[model samples]
Target: MRIAIFGKQFDPAFDEYCLALFRHLSLTGAGICIYKPFYEFVSGIPSIKLNPDSVFKDHADLPECDMLFSIGGDGTFLDAVTIVRDRPIPIVGINSGRLGFLADVSKDELPSALNDIFEGHYKVRQLDLLKLDTHIPAFGELDFALNEFAVAKRDSSSMITIHANLNGDYLNSYWADGLIIATATGSTAYSLSVGGPIMHPASKNLIINPIAPHNLTVRPLVVPNDFDLTLRVESRGGSYLVSLDSRSCILEESIELKIRKADFSVSVIERNGKTFYSTLRSKLMWGADRRN
Candidate 1:
């Protein structure tokens, strides 16, 4: 099997696990194609020696592979999505630190996870994503986000007014710090922090969440993913910050913004015996209370 390795800088304590992962892959006779910068970082470790079949700097140079291994935290997993964009490669996220929704495989479970993967004991799940369109070509080809598309006031302390519409019909004017158009996969991200409800990953829904609204009556709203959303912002600074997952850009003017579900989806590998409910219980400490 051919594997593509994409990663970011990790703590020195994870060197041993990194080495072990590489050795396991080598033993499995998997052709390795690593990200160039990650290769440089790993090679710098005195205890490690890597001889990858190829190296890729970006999506343009990434070679064809059966799967891509994202080694880092959840942030790194998001970065991997940008590289794999619309591709069929299933991503396996290996967490180097605390477990995350995306990077669910912990270091202690690494060996078994790798074994399951090589033995073909896993399932591939498709994740939905949201696409953004603006009058100005701000995000370019990478205009989609697996999590959310957010608009926030920039360069001023004053709150921004976001006029929202659904399928060309006026919805509401939000007087708040910003607005978030989050997919079901993003309900746990920024939207959650601002009082949005957690949603099932498979739910075909989009979350319309406002950030710190001046009125207490404003609450997060869930809508069908099929609806098209339009937003216009009136900010004191005349500019706003727009972010798609981990990438962000400053929009100098309040151009009309449109959002819809992306045409394609991302494929993520889920090892056998690992369920989303189990992850929720473990991560959120659902049963940790002494009374429970």
Candidate 2:
């Protein structure tokens, strides 16, 4: 079996766990490849010397691997998605930081996780992604977001007016700092922070959440994933920022944005005992109360 590891620069606190992961994987005799940047980051560390089968700097250099391991936090996991774009390879996340929603596995669980993978004690789950459409491409050919697609005012103080339409029918005009269209995978991300309801990962729904809306009555709405949504933003600065997970770009107010479910979905590796509900309870501290 072949596994590709990807990560970005992380705090020194996570260096040991990262090194341990590499050492354990290398010992398994599985074909190992590391992203060039991550390999360079650990080059100076005496404890972590990796003679990987391949060192990849870009997606084109990524060889066919059975699985890809994303090291670091959720941001690194999102970055891993960009490389595994439209690929069938299942990506697993190894958390080396706090609050790892996407990077579900902890350093303590690394050995068991690997054991599960090697012993075929894992399943591949498909995650839905939101695709962006615009006249001029902002995020290149890979315009899909695993978490969400958000549009917000560029300036800090001002709220933007986002005209939204669902299936060519007027939905509502949002007067807020920003708006988020999140997949079920993203319901726990930016949307949840702003009072959006959490949807199960298998749900065929999308969340339309407003960020600090002028009217309190305008709450987050859930819609079918199949509907095509259109958005036009008007900001005082004449520009707005649109983010696809960790990637973002500024766009002119005149640019119209369209969002729909991506034709493809990313596969995530779910080891035994790591279910959606279990992750929610552990990560979000769901139902944890001293009084209870």
Determine which window of 10 residues in candidate 2 has minimal summed lDDT: 41-50
Q: How many clashes show up in model 2?
A: 0
Candidate achieving the largest TM-score:
1
lDDT of 1 by residue, 1-292 (tens): 9999999999998999999999999999999999999999999999999999999999999999999999999899999999999989999999998858888888888999999999999999999999998877899989999989999988557998999999999999999989999998888788988999989899999999999998889999999999999988888778889999999998865498999999999999998999888888987788899888
Q: What clash pairs does model 1 have?
A: none
Model 1 residue 251 lDDT score: 82
Tens-digit lDDT track for model 2 on 80-169? 999998899999998887888889998888888888988999899999999999999798977999999999988879899999999999
